[model samples]
Target: MPVSLTIIPELNLVHIIYSGQVTPKELFEETQACYQRPEYKPGMAEVSDFFQVTSFEIGYDEVHEFTSRSKSTHGGVDIGTDICLVGSTKVSEPAILMYEGMIAAKEIPIRLHVLPGYPEALAVLNLPEDSLKYFPEGCHTERHLL
Candidate 1:
């Protein structure tokens, strides 16, 4: 799979890492599957890392539709969650901006941040500085990866 999901329940964080060439179907399917996992919580913060993604095949319609469905699953009158996007200018900026636009248009109350890498994402989420020091290489058993 080009996409992998890692949920760190203790930190109320979920990291979705994408690599190689990715399609809209693969991306959304992995995300929806992640939502169905037992470890997923409604308000948990998300770090969507598109750093290694060489190509992201998505567009306005796909993002809009996903955001619409996502609103039903993650929107309400309560406090919203944070979503940090780890991406690069060439590969993922357009899609990130589109998703941001959708969220804003729908007024879903999700705080989205676009950062360069994992360190920045950790800072935005207010997590420990060293939280992902050994990530994607060596991780604790507590982190459930799918």
Candidate 2:
């Protein structure tokens, strides 16, 4: 299936939901399409809700292309990412390492909520706990519950 992308303004983040069936380039295009919308604004961070991601590949070239394109198109906005959840089961060490490396190399700070569900992700993201009144728990996923 084609990846789904959503931008949450309150959190200043972009959420990408994808199934491994799609290529990273396809997903990239979909995300770019969303940013092309006049209503879409450059977010400070990105969250890849791989909860449904079955399988995929993202090499250095793809990463560089995506970030460079985003920076140029989004008014020089930097990109940070949260990829704590993507598959149907537990996250793999290699995947985690890859994400960690990406975040480090890109120099973009990201938050990883190892809890089983989304609530924990929000907590790790440092969203105001008391401000839960202001932000709903929609973004919380099962991965955060771990």
Candidate 3:
């Protein structure tokens, strides 16, 4: 799989890394699975890394679909949190922007930040640059799929 999710309960953070080419289905599945995990708390900050991603097989329709699914599954509650999107190259920027736009349009109350790299993500979250050292080593899996 090209996508993985890592949840760091200690930091109240979740890191999602997308590599190669990613599809909406894979992303949705991993995200839904993350929600089911004991470590996943509402309003946890997220770092979504697309640095290794070559492309995203997503579009307006997919964004709409995912947004709907997310709202329904999460019960339309305020899951308000900070989300940092990293490494948005030309190939993946559109998808990232579309999702951010959708979230705004729906009044989701999330604070979304689009940055060039993880260092910026850390800074935005007020975490130390070396904080990544706390992430579980080899925690990448489709299920805790980082």
Please state every model's RMSD to the true fold in angstroms.
5.0, 5.0, 5.4
Q: Model 2, stretches more than 4 Å misplaced?
A: 10-12, 70-75, 78-96, 108-116, 126-146
For model 1, residues 41-112, the per-residue Cα lDDT tens digits are: 898888887767888888889999889877976796278889988766587778888989899999986898
The prediction achieving the highest lDDT against the true structure is: 1
Whose TM-score is greatest here?
A: 1
Error of 2 at 20 (Å): 3.5
lDDT, ranked from best to worst: 1, 3, 2
Pitting candidate 2 against candidate 3, the one with the higher lDDT is 3
- Per-residue lDDT of model 2, residues 30-113, tens digit only: 977877866576544555555555555666566666655544554344453343443334433344455456555655444444
Model 3 agreement with the true structure over 18-130: per-residue lDDT tens digits: 88989988988999899899888877888888877887999999999887765565444474678898778998989988988898787676788998666677779998655
Q: Between prediction 1 and prediction 2, which has the larger lDDT?
A: 1
Q: Model 3: runs farther than 4 Å from truth?
A: 72-79, 136-146
Report lDDT (Cα) of residue 145, candidate 2: 43
Could you tell me every candidate's TM-score relative to the true structure?
Answer: 0.87, 0.59, 0.85
Runs in model 1 with CA error above 4 Å?
A: 138-146
